[model samples]
Target chain A: DQQVKQNSPSLSVQEGRISILNCDYTNSMFDYFLWYKKYPAEGPTFLISISSIKDKNEDGRFTVFLNKSAKHLSLHIVPSQPGDSAVYFCAASKGSNYQLIWGAGTKLIIKP
Target chain B: EPEVTQTPSHQVTQMGQEVILRCVPISNHLYFYWYRQILGQKVEFLVSFYNNEISEKSEIFDDQFSVERPDGSNFTLKIRSTKLEDSAMYFCASSEDRGQGHQPQHFGDGTRLSIL
Candidate 1:
């Protein structure tokens, strides 16, 4: 069962533009959410995360917005760079739980 | 910045044979995990380890799969009688104490296991 779903299999955006990736979850018990970026042949790299108590968290050019009532979250990368072209995965876990339920991932392509 | 490291970038083993994948997490991290991703499939969690014991595990971690911290710097996943379906890219990850807050997990490059 897919508890976390990234409906977009792939997305292409122009460099210097904003790229938005969306994620939906069926489990409301998940209290913490995170976004990870992965490149070919490399393991996933942690990008950012948000707690259920918060609606949004931002770091540099990346911002993650969580809508707890809708069980949905989105990651926004402003002024997307070529380096941002990678697979983005959304993961969530409940209170103090070590296990992270992950999405299938969205392949983001930044075109110059 | 310290990062998790895994050994044997690629491994090829015959079906039914035992295989072991090794990892060394960041020195200061306290939590460790094992995950695998099959070709064109989502990454699946296998097990989580802390305080020298299993903290959590998924159904994919069946009787044939095992994890160990053989040394202060090493964590290993041993598959006793592997099946062809077990062939996948196995990743090792580590995170700081959760008591502070939700610490992001850092992953290793992963070892690609190919069961022949």
Candidate 2:
């Protein structure tokens, strides 16, 4: 099912620049959205999250923006570091059920 | 920091053999879930367990697949009979109460199962 989708398979950015990742969902019932970062052989690490009630949520250098009208969401990491290079996944869930619908993930490559 | 633990990082079994994947979620976490990701694909949810019973399951979780919390600490997923398509990386995750919004689930370094 293509409920969630990450159109970009890969992204490249400078180490000290801003990195933006985009995601789209077809299901409007999704209320909670989360971003995860994963290394080559490790499980996904929770990064940031935002609820449908709010349009933006920021933590440190990570910010998640949600556009309910467009059924789209984006993640922005300021001053990207080399360690930030990994596959980023955007997930969405409905209410309290917590069954996460995941995207194909975008591989971020930070260049120094 | 507490983290989820999974056993047998890599498992190779015959197509008709039965396989059991084990996971130990973080302490104090009540909600548990199982998900699998095939090569070059998105992660797909299999099942979610809470309060000693299944709360939700996806279509991918067929009759051949089952989950159990045999003891107080460990949760397991068993495949009755494996098929070639059963090869994938299985991940276990846990979280606290679901009533609260934005409770991010903690995931374990998944177990990779390869059906021969």
Candidate 3:
């Protein structure tokens, strides 16, 4: 029973274009959502997140949109850079204590 | 920015041997968790701890596995008798609290354990 899922295994986009990654959840009790970017041989680094109350959250070039009714969320990176190429994992936490349901991760490749 | 830290970036242990993985979560964070990922697999939650007690744990956390916050700053995961299937990258993450959008968890570099 995977509560969180990223259906796309990988995505490719040109530099300076937009890269959108999607995620869905089955557990309605999840109140908070998070994104993490990981590179080879390193731990996942925290990215942006949004609460179920909000529709969107943005930080610099990255943005996250959450639709509670749809039980879905997506991450958008504008003007995608080569540096953004990595495995992006979408995570959701129910109440607290940092327990997260993680997706397998979507690998993004930026074409120059 | 305070971040989680793990020691002995890599460990190779023989089957049936006891192994302890250490971690130091962010100072102000109130929650700590341990997760593991097999090569090319999704990260799986193991256990979460708060107030010196386990808040939640997955089926993966069997009787052979135990967690302890021995002192002020250290969180450890111990495998009493590790098996070959125990080989994986163990990650430690910390969050300030739950339900807050800023509750972004910071993760350690992870301890990669190889069981032989």
Candidate 1 structure quality by residue, lDDT tens digits, A34-100: 9999999999999999999999999999999999889999999999999999999999988543788
Instruction: Give candidate 3's TM-score.
Output: 0.96
lDDT of 3 by residue, B1-116 (tens): 78899988999999999999999999988789999998878899999999999989999999999999999999999998999999999999888875443577789999999999
lDDT of 1 by residue, B3-116 (tens): 999999999999999999999999999999999999999899999999999999999999999999999999999999999999999999999989878888899999999999
- Ranked candidates (DockQ, high to low): 2, 1, 3
**What residue runs in model 3 are displaced by over 4 Å at the alpha carbon?**
B99-102
Question: Which DockQ values do the candidates obtain, in the order shown?
Answer: 0.73, 0.74, 0.65
The worst-scoring run of ten residues by lDDT in candidate 1 chain A lies at: A93-102
lDDT of 1 at A28: 85
Fnat of each prediction, in sequence:
0.64, 0.67, 0.65
Itemize residue pairs with steric clashes in candidate 1.
Answer: none
Model 1 misplacement above 4 A:
none
Question: What are the Cα lDDT values of the candidates?
Answer: 0.95, 0.94, 0.92
